[model samples]
Target: MNLLKTSVFNCLFVCSLIFFLFFLLLFPKESFNAALNGLVLWFRMIIPALLPFAIISGIFIRFHIADYFSFLFKPIIGTIFDLSNEGSFCVLAGFLFGYPMGAKIANDLVVDRQLSKNEGEYLFLFCNQASPVFILNCVAINCFKNENLFLPIFIILLSTSITIGIVLRKFFYKSLKWDSKEKVLKSLNDNTSPFEILDSCVMNGVDTILKLGAYIILFSIIVKMVEIILKDFYYLKTLIIGFLEMTNGISYISSLNTSFQIHFLFVLFCVSFGGISCIFQTASMVKNSHFSMIKYLIVKIMTAFISILYGILYLKFIY
Candidate 1:
């Protein structure tokens, strides 16, 4: 079964890449515009938001700064999540920095042995989430055209990631736990000077961000091709767009003549799922680590569905 599934996935992936190449050749204008949009977004929104956090998170991990979390904050957040100081730091990075950053930080922690292998894999699953700025500003105001919609969207997205993480932790990863006292920070990176470490982090962060930009551009082009090919099946086109890359999907969703409920649910699903582009970016980040991309993808699909369920309840009761 596993071999069959892997073969199927490989076949689809190869076909998709070939089709994308066809898109590049056939519709150069559309593809150029799509690439431009993705590049502009990466330069304007993603870089400013992520680069600083990326460098900071890397420095924090390298310096074992999480070990010095304040007495007030540490006891509450650390104990609550059953995380060591480092894991608690990752939660903050996840919430604040968003998506693959949390995953990157979690992978770093496991490499540094700040978290056990089970804990690290478990941490990235849920800690990886959409940015608050993207949720509140991009999706809520820009796409939905209503700032008031932020609360419901925020609640649903946050709740879904947390709930999914908690359920998986309870069932499959029974052995993962953090004992702060037991953790001893040891690092092979200790030989580096502060300057070297800072330089390395900045370089790595920029490289990661560039890869993210590439995925975004690649998927943006693919989504544009979807637009032309599936114009008759509007709903299907939208789903395919949302599945490929998130930002373009949200922009496309906004321009549609759908009902408010449709807008809300599609945005909810796109943000919740993090899109295929997001999944690929995340997988690249942890490719060297023990983290499971398959598990992450499965959980993301689950999150998308759960977000819609939450959206339904919210729309029925609260909206």
Candidate 2:
């Protein structure tokens, strides 16, 4: 079955590449602009938002600051999530930073042997969320045209993530505390200078952000291609675009002349799913790690439904 899946994936991947190449040859200007726009978005939004956090998160883990800080929430995350010192820290970082950061941190922790493979997957299942920045700025203000929607959107996303986390923890981790049981923690570098740690963090951060930028650029082109290729089945095209890349999908959905509730639910779904682009980004971060993309998608699908449920309740009663 795995072999069959792999074969099918390879065929689809090759076909997609061929189509992309052909389309690029046909519309060089559009592809170039798409790449350029992706780069600009990365520079303007991703870098400014991510670089500092990456560096600081690296330091936090390396110096074991996250352990101390995460311990503070032992009463809550500790007891409820039943995580270790490292996993607890991830809870905060995952929710706050969003996206691949959660996956990135989990990979780092697992590499350092501070967290076991199962423990990493436990966090990976639920911690990785859509960026609050993207939700507020892109979805709420730009797409929905209402900054006030931020609070409710936030509530739905947050509740869904936490709910999924708890459920997965029960199903996967059970009641035990997840930590470095078999995987011993990496030895602390006593001789390493603070400057050395900072330098390492900076380099890793730059590398990660660059990789993320490339994915963004690639997906931006794919979204553009979808727009150009499928003229028929307008709604089908919109769903495909949204499933592939979220920001563009939400933009397309919002531009249509629809009632507010329909628009709101669709927009809510996009943010909740975090797009195929975000999934690839997260997968990239944990490529060699124990985290499973299949499992991640299951979590995302579950969250999307949960979020829609919340959206309906909000629209029906709260909004």
Candidate 3:
């Protein structure tokens, strides 16, 4: 059965690639423009916003900064999420820096034997999220043109993430044991020189960012191709693009002459789900680890749904 499934998957993947190539050939101009747009976005927005966070995270890990913060974070994270001290760093990175950072940190912890596979998997679900900066600055103020929406959107996203974490901890991670304290402590005590650590961190950060950029470009092209194919159905096109790549999806939605409520809901959903592009990027980050991308995808979908529900409730009650 497993072999048959694998064969079927391979066939489907080959067919999809062939279809994509044919589409590219059919619409060369569209493909070129889309690829160019992706490049612009990578160099303009993603690089500036993401690179510093990646480098800082690398430095933090290399220098065992998490160990210092772990003492303060352990009590709260442990009580709420049933996670160890190291898990607090993943939470902090995810909340502060956003998408794939949390996953990257969890992967690093797992690789260093600071966190067990089960704990890492649990962290992967809720720790990886849209950054507050992206939500407030990019989406709320810039895209929506309403500073008032910033607090609401930020609160909703943060609350939903914490709620998901709590629920998952209570149900899924109850059976998983924490890593050995001695091993974690040993890994935290690195004797490498500061210059050497800095060099390694910079190199690793560059490699990770490059990989992220490639995924963004690939998905941007795919999303554009999909939009070209579904030209007539504007709503469907908006959703399809959003599902494939978030920034483009939000851009399309914002351009439309739609109701504020509709626009708000759509943006909320897209940001929460983070689109397929983000999923692929995160999967690449955790490929070497035992974290399950499939499970993470499910969590994203659930979070999106919850966000939609919260928006609706807020509208009915407050707005």
Candidate 4:
């Protein structure tokens, strides 16, 4: 399953790449250049947002801040998730801090023999998704101006879906056990100043933002075409566009002059899909880890579907 998903996504990415190149070649010089300009702008937007977070996240991990974060989430994790002490820490820190960070923590746990391989994989499935801060503050508030707190409510529901789905998977497959050997945490010298951490954070965040920005720009061009097509055929654009490029799909949907319910559904779908960009990013991170791209998609898609259903139900009864 994992291999199949990897192959499919890879094919899509390659096709997009080819199409984009063709677009540059076939379009008039001025139009192609304008699209390139847009792509550059998108890169600028995405890189800064992401690069600092990535670096800071790395520094935090290197300094064992993630371990400390794990400690803080212990009570909630212990009581609610019913996880082991160490397992709870990994899960909570991953859930609270950020993406791939949680995965990183889990990977470390697996490497150290603290968490079983199966448990680590399970943690990777659910815990390594978007944090509340990113989804609500970054996407909802910043992107959509949805001060009505729609994003937060949706994220709460989305997280619940992820958790439920993961639990169900665990119930069906059962978890595998491995060695439980403990390893000492790495230490950073005190001479490392706070500025260094800040700098690293900035650099990492920039890197992440730039990558996403480039993707956004490329996707925006494709979306422009889709919009034209939708002018004549306005059904299921969100669904089709999202499967191709997630963030662009979300942005396009958010830009629609639609009703609150439609907007809600669009947001639900966008968030659930996490966009193709997110899947690729996650896949890139786990390339060497024990994580499976296919499994991640299955989990991601299922959770996304559940979130969409929840949103639909909310619209039907509550909204």
Candidate 5:
């Protein structure tokens, strides 16, 4: 396995280097311009989230607040989803934070031997959705320009449906099981210094953010290239463009003179798939930890489908 990883990494490094050189040779003007734009976008969207998130995560984990919250949700989780306390706690955190942060928290708890790896794996599907903060503030209010709280509400509902399907499949249907005999819970020592947690959080955040930025730039170039090649193909371009670039996809769908149902379904898919850019960027960030891209994608696709179903039902009831 180690040998395979090494070989793969070497191949990727070489391929990327070759691509860079070839791009520079063939399209120096575009390459430099694209690189500059990438840097700017990285600074704008990626960098700002790094330090603050790190520090906040550190404080939460270090203070044992996460554990406390986990305990509080234990009963609700057990009753509702038949999940463990740790799982519920991580789910709650994911609801508050977004993407890799949620995944990161679960990863940390697993490493600390607080939850069984299998349970962590199960919770991961539910725990890896857009936070309420992002959906409400960033997407619903800011992006959609509509005050209808239903947007975020439906997003949460759709996310929940996706998580449920993933859990059911992994645990019972798909027969994909996590290692059950890994570890047990830990008593958080009060003496664990605050600085240590802070340092870990900041370092992890920076590393994750930079990794995300690398993927963002790469995927952005791919998106740009694909858009140029298929400039005339409207439907294919719209679909691919939406998948590769999230906000742009939403904008495209919104501009179409289509039915409300189509628009709603597109929005749901954009939120669920989170675009190729989002997936690539997020996968890059959380790759260091025990995150499963396959499982995540499965859950995302399921969520998109469920969101559409819910929208159909909603429209039927309204009409």
Candidate 6:
């Protein structure tokens, strides 16, 4: 059965790659322009926003500040998610910074042996999120043209993430057990020099950002091809693009002359989903680790559904 599954997957992957390459060859100019735009977006927005957080997160992990943070938040995180102090740090980072940061931090903890594979996999499910900054500024204020929606949207996303974390913890409680508590405690006692740690953090942060950028560019090309193919079906095209890359999807939806409620709900759903581009970036982050992309994808879809339902309830109550 395993061999059959692997063979089927390989065939699908190869066929998909071939189809993608054929589009690239057929529309060389479009593909090139899309790739360039993706690169520009990365340099102008993604790097400035994410690099500092990534570096600080690395420094925190290297100097064991994350361990201290984990310790401080352990009671709440432990009770809710059944994570150790280190895993708690991953959750905090995800809540604050968002996206592949959660996956990156989870991978880091797993690499350092602070979290067992099960714990890492569990954390990976809900820790990867869209940052509050993006939600408030881009989606709420800019896209919806309503700053009032910020609190509701933020609350919805946060509640959904926490709820999913708790649910996953309950479902996997037995399998998600931690390793030695002493080892987790000992991680807080790192003896590395500050300078060395800083250097390592900077390099690691750059490497991670670059890898993230590549995925963004590749997916941007794919999204562009998809857009070209589905130009007539604007609504469906918007959704498909959003499924591939979230920012583009949100921007497309916001430009439409739709009702405010419909626009808001779609944006909320896309932001909650975080797009296939983010999933691939996250998958890359945990590629060598024990984290399960399938599990993460399932939890993300659930969160997206929850976000839409919450948005509907909020709208009914508010207006």
Candidate 1 residue runs with Cα over 4 Å from true position: 1-12, 70-72, 178-184, 187-190
lDDT of 6 by residue, 128-147 (tens): 89998888888887788888
**Ten residues in sequence with the least summed lDDT for candidate 6:** 180-189
The predictions' CA RMSDs to the true structure, in order, are 2.5, 1.8, 2.0, 5.0, 4.6, 2.4
Tell me the spans in candidate 4 whose CA falls farther than 4 Å from its real position.
Answer: 1-18, 28-45, 84-117, 131-134, 137-145, 165-169, 172-178, 181-214, 221-231, 255-259
Give the alpha carbon lDDT tens digit for every residue of 147-172 in model 2. 99988998889888888988888776
For model 3, the superposed segments whose C-alpha errors exceed 4 Å read: 175-192
How would you encode candidate 1's per-residue C-alpha lDDT over 95-153 as one tens digit per residue?
66777798998998887777887888988888899888888889988998888888778
Better of 3 and 6 by TM-score: 3
Q: Of models 1 and 3, which has the larger TM-score?
A: 3
What TM-score do all the candidates reach, one by one? 0.91, 0.94, 0.93, 0.71, 0.77, 0.91
**lDDT of the candidates, in the order given:** 0.83, 0.86, 0.84, 0.62, 0.64, 0.85
Residue 262 displacement (Å), model 2: 1.2
Which candidate do you rate higher for TM-score, 2 or 5?
2
Query: What is candidate 1's local distance difference test score?
Result: 0.83
Q: Candidate 4's error at 286, in angstroms?
A: 1.4
Find the candidate with the highest lDDT and give its number. Answer: 2
State the lDDT of candidate 5 residue by residue for 74-127, as single tens digits.
786555566555667777766566665666766666666665655666566555
- For model 2, the stretches where C-alpha displacement exceeds 4 angstroms are 1-5, 175-183
RMSD (CA, Å), candidate 2 to true, equals 1.8
For lDDT, candidate 3 versus 5, the one ahead is: 3
| Per-residue lDDT over 3-73 for candidate 3, one digit per residue giving the tens place of the 0 to 100 score | 99999999999999999999889988988888888888889978888888888877776667776777788
Sort by TM-score, top down from the best: 2, 3, 6, 1, 5, 4
For model 4, the run of ten residues with the poorest summed lDDT: 178-187
Residue-pair clashes, model 3:
0
User: Candidate 5 — which residues are off by over 4 angstroms?
Assistant: 1-42, 46-51, 141-143, 149-159, 162-193, 285-291
